[model samples]
Target: MLLKEPRLNFTDVMNRKAQEKGIQLDNDQQRLIRHLETLAETLLRRRAAFAGLYLWGQPGRGKSFIVDSFFAALPLAQKKRAHFHTFFRELHQQLNGQGLDAALLELMGEARLLCFDEFHLHDIGDAMLVKRLIALAIARNVALIFTSNYPPRALLANPLYHDRFVPSIALIERHMTVMALNGPRDYRQQATGHGVFSEGAYLWPASAARRQALGLPDASGAVALTVGHRTLHAASSPGEFLHFTFAGLCEAPTAVMDYLALCEGHERWFLDGVPPLARVSPAAQQRFINLVDVLYDQQRRLFIAAACPLTELVAGVEQEDIARTASRLSQLTTE
Candidate 1:
C-alpha cells in the first residue's frame, strides 16, 4: 500500500492507502487531523512540553498510520515511540533494576515526546500501572500520544475493577483531547492488487532432499520436520516465516478445536484463507478471535491472506462482536 499521498488528510491515510486511491475525510475528522497536526507542530516548536492526546476509533480507521507519519516527519532524536506491549515489557525490565518511580520519572524526563501505539486499558494490571505512569509523566511535562479502540471514558471496560479507572479517566480528560475518527468504509478494502506472504504453510522437501534441491533451509530455519501429519517449512526471517492456506492447514482427523490447540505454541503465523470460522457461525467467530488473540499475546507475527489487507477484514465483517475482533486483529499488525 502507498502510504505517501500528500493529498490525503492525516486521518484518511490508511483508507487512502488501502484503496491506492484517495478517500476524503469527513469534517470532524479533518478538524481532528488539524488538531493533531497543531499538536505535532507545537511539540516541534517547544523543546519541553508534556501532555497526552488520545485518538480512538474502530479498527482500520487509520489511527496508527497518522501517528507513524507524524513521527516520521519529525527529527528522530526528539522522539521515543513503541508499541504498547514493548513499552510495558521494557518498563517492567527497567523497574526491576531501578525501581518503578525512578524508571518512570527517568523515561518521562528524558522523552520530549512519547507515543504508545495501541494503548489499551482493558485489564486491571494495565489500568493500575498506567495510572501511575500517566501521573508521573504529566507531572514531568512529557508529551504523549496514543491510539485505542475505546474512547477515553470507555477504557478499562472490565466491570470487575471498573471503579479503579475513575482516576485514570479523569486524568485523561484533564490532560488531553479525545477524538474519534470514523469512516463509511474500511480502508483495508482497497487492497485490490497487493500480495501477502507467509512461510509456515509452504510444503517443502525432506532435509537432505531440500539441501540437494534448493541448497538452503526451506523457511523455518530448521531441517525440515513434520509436525503431526503436516510438514513445517522454514523461512529466512521471522516475518517471512510460516503461512497456511486456511483450509489445508485446518483439515485433519483432529476436530477444528484440536487444530486450534496446535497453534497455541506458535508465536508467528501467516493465515491465507477466510478462516472457516468466519463463514460459519457467531460462536465460530468468537473462537477465531480467541485464536487470533492467543497468537497476539505470544507476540507472534501474523500475516493474513485476504482479498483485501488489514482494513477489509474489518469492513467485510459487520457484526459488532466480529468488528471488535477485527479491531483486535488490526492492533497486532500496526502500532
Candidate 2:
C-alpha cells in the first residue's frame, strides 16, 4: 500500500485548532481557511509566480484569527509576523537615518514571508514609505499576507487627502489578491458571555463605585512612567492599575511603543475624562484608535469614563476604523 501524505494544509490545522479550543468552525471561516490553505501551499512551494493575499473584513469577523493560524502552521522558516502598529513604529525608527531600501533590507532580513496584522494607512508619511516598501517587497519576491479591518479602497479614509495614498492603494490592489471575510457573527460580542477578560474586558462610563471595586484609590495623583528616554505622566497610578485622562494619553505625542510598554507592565488600565469622539482633534482620535487596538490585541483590561456611550463615542471622521474600536469596546462590561 502507498503511504498517505501528511495533512498539513491550512484547513487541517485550523480544524485541529478549533477542536482543541472547543470552537465550532462556521461556514465563512471554513471558506477562508480553504483560501488560506491554497496560499500557504503556494508559499511553501516557493512558487515564483505566486502573488500575496490581502484579507479584510469588519471587526470581530475572524480575519486575524484565521491569518494567525495560517502563519503559525506554515512549515517554512523564513517568516515574520508583526502587528502593523508595532511594525511601523520600528520601521520608522529604523528609517530615521537609513534610506527606505536599506531599512527594508534590515527589516526583512531572512524573511521571505511577511505577515502584517491590523494593516492600515493613516499618515501621508507612512503611506509614501509603505508604497515604496510594497514595490520593493514584491520585486524581491517576498510573499505578503495582511489582515485588516479596511479594504484597500477604504484605507487612508481622510476625505481631503485620500487621493494622496492612491499609489499605495493601487500597489496593494495590483499585487495582492484581496479577500473579504464577511462572516455574519461578531465573535467578540458572542464571547462576552464567557466573562470580561475571556470575552472582552472593557468597561465604559466607569462609575465611582466601579472605581472603588477595582481598588482605585479615593485620592489620585500624577505618576511618571518611564519608557526608554521618555517619561510619560499618568493621572493616577494606584497599585497595578495606571489611570490616564483621555487628553493626557491620546493628545500628546505619545508613541505606540509607550502604550505597548504600559500594556506589558500593567495588568489593568483606567482612562478617565473620555470626551465625545467629536470633541477630540483628528490626531487625538487617531491616537485613541491606536490605543484601543493595542489594548485589545494585548488582551489588557480597560476601564474608561466616557462622556457618551460607546455607540455615540465614534465621530463621523474615520468612522470605519473607529467603528472597529467601538466593536471591540462593546465586549467590555459597562456599569
Candidate 3:
C-alpha cells in the first residue's frame, strides 16, 4: 500500500499539540518525539523488520498524549487505534464464534498502522491471545504502535506464566523499537482543566446532603439489567443517569465485557457504596479497576460516592494498574 507523507513532521505536530495545552514537554517526552520521528520515517518508507514501536512508562507521563499525536499525524488509510482491553474483548467475542484465523482477519480489516493504548496484561489467558495477535500483525505487515505502562518483558509477570510469555516478549523485542517515557511528573494526575473527565467528581462519605445538592439519585431499589446472557441487578435510578452499587458493579461475576456493553448504553455512571480497597475481595477490587479503566479511557463521566476519601479508596492496592487507577481517579473532582 502506497502511503503519503504527512504535511507536518512528527516533532512539530507533537510540540504544537503540547503547546496548545500549555504543556512544556519534559526531557523524556521530548526524547520520545525524536524516536517517533525516526519511526515515522521508517513507516513512511513502508514496512521494515523493526516496524513497530513499543512505548512504556510509569502512570501518566504523557504516553497517551504522544501516542495520540503520533496516531493522528499518520496519514495511513487503513490505520486503526483502540484501547487494549476493549480491543481484545471484542476480538475474543469473535474468536469464540469464529476461531483465530477468521477473527484476526475480520477484526483487523485493513490497518497498516495499529495503535493500542494502555496495554498490559494480568491473565495468562489474555497473554496467549495477545501472542497470536502480535504474530498476525507482523505477518500481515501491519505497522504497529503500542502505548503501555510496562515494558514487554515485564508484562504477564507471574512466575508460572512468565516463561511461557518469553517467546512473545522476544518476538516483541525483535520486531519493535522499545522506548521508555519515564519522567518524574504524571501529567494525568495534574489538574489541567481536561474536559469531560475533569468535570466528573469523586464524592466521599456518601453523604445525603452532597447527593441531594448534586441531584444524584439514590440506590433506593434494585433493577435488573440484561448484559449479554447474564442478568445484572444494579441500584435503581431516576432514568436520567445509570446508578449501581459497588457490590453490583464489582463484587459479583462482572468482567470488562459487562462494563463495555453497559458503557455503550450509558455515558454518565454512578458507583456508590465504594469501600476502601483493602476491605473488598481481590476479585471485586480488580473489577472496579477495570471499571475505572474503561470509563477513563473512553472519557466517560464517573461520579464515585465512596465511604472514604480518594487516597484511601485506592490506597495499598498492589494491582499492576493501581497507580494508573490512582492517576485517573486523581483527575476527577474530589468533594
Per-residue lDDT of candidate 2, residues 62-178 (tens digit): 887788877777877899998888788788789889888898889999888999989888777878877887888898889888889888998888887789998788888988988
Global lDDT of each candidate: 0.57, 0.78, 0.84
- What's the distance in Å from true for residue 215, model 2? 1.7
How do the residues 153-216 of candidate 3 rate in per-residue lDDT, one tens digit apiece?
A: 8999889889999999999999888989888888876637766766778897667998888778
Model 2 residue pairs with clashes: 202-332
Ranking by TM-score: 3, 2, 1
Q: Is candidate 1 or candidate 3 better by lDDT?
A: 3
Off by over 4 Å in 3: 1-7, 47-50
The alpha-carbon deviation from the true structure for residue 34 of candidate 2, after best TM-score superposition, in angstroms, is: 1.7
**Candidate 1 — what's its lDDT?**
0.57
